[model samples]
Target: MSKDSSQSFLLSDSAMQAASYSTYQNFQSSPTLCASELQNWKQRIGLFQTHLQTTATPTQGSLFDTTSTQTSLDSIKPFELRRQNTEFWRWQFDDVGVPAMYFVIDYIATAQKGPILLYIGETVKSNQRWKGVHDCKRYLTNYQQAHRDTGLKSELAIAFWPQAPADRPARQKLESQLIYKWRSPFNKENWRYWNTPFITGKEP
Candidate 1:
């Protein structure tokens, strides 16, 4: 549930100077523009590119089922403990712990006569190589076959896995037990499904 480590990298003085020089020189050829305007444009472009390159990955926190925007993004930290190196953190799975899939339900509309639950899944394998879960539809197929009128349908969200051990049978069993014990709203027909309200808040 937590990150493996946190390490911050500070750019060397020479490297910083070089980067500043490159940014300034990029606008040097614009003879038709005023100096102030050129500097402002460069600053804005730099900020925009930074935004695109650095997104808040799932490791930092969940998206909370909201659309990404300047405000939401600003609410998140620019630098995270998990983002050590771009390539290293990207799709880095947890291999020694829970080597299995996990789900987060996006929404549960209890107001309706037949409310729906949005379930998202993640698959964790060894080698710390993380990938999105694609078997949500397949899992729904199996669930539907077992119970024709359970009314559980698949509504997949952004997927990613954690690092976990190869001996994952325990994880699968735990998931099954949790699902049964909680009687997740996923199984609407069950009396335990949606019996209580679920609350989520924006965590800092």
Candidate 2:
């Protein structure tokens, strides 16, 4: 394997170790929720579980075309972004973060979906974004529980783009474009396409 591949393997292993250790701690304290996690599965799982029940039924709408998502030459694919070095820990780490275009991703790939891009966002305060009130955090809770309930593996991590435009308006415009392009399920704009269960009373 190449140098980059070796580093990636080490990173992936460390993330797994962190998650395993956290999960063990959570299980020791509370069966359903971890200290790092904001909400309990019971609180968020109900809606997602119900939605999963009917996923077999045919749906009419189309998901955003992730295959067509693009980035400037200086940028990489959303899935290509890694934790810390570029991504910094969105879950368990120091809150000091940088201005970046960020992605919330499920690293585990299934034959059906490959790696799941749950949300795409841009933030001047990438690390501090979750430090304040953020709805996306709750959505992520549900999304993870949805996977767990179905025995699906999910390696949820946040990543960043160092090349994001410095201007807030320009950065936000790029964020909007990518969000629409990927139609990431947790993002409100594409929630309808995925039958996102966490949306209030709407089944988006």
Please give, for residues 140-201, the per-residue lDDT of candidate 2 as tens digits. 55555655655656666767665566689778766776666555667888766665555332
* Candidate 2 worst ten-residue window by lDDT: 22-31
Compared with the true structure, all predictions reach lDDT values of 0.30, 0.51
Off by more than 4 A, model 2:
1-75, 84-95, 200-204
Tens digit of per-residue lDDT, candidate 1, span 1-204: 445421012223443334332111111111233434423432443343244345532322332334533243234222221211112212323333334333333222221221222232223432232223222333333322322233433222222234322345644433343333323343333224333111211112
Evaluated with lDDT, which candidate comes out highest? 2
Candidate RMSDs in Å, in order, are 21.5, 10.5
Q: TM-score of predicted model 1?
A: 0.27
Backbone steric clashes in candidate 1, count: 7
Q: Name every residue pair that clashes in candidate 1.
A: 93-163, 94-162, 94-163, 94-164, 95-163, 95-164, 95-165
Worst 10 residues of 1 by lDDT: 21-30
Clashing pairs in 2: 84-88, 196-204
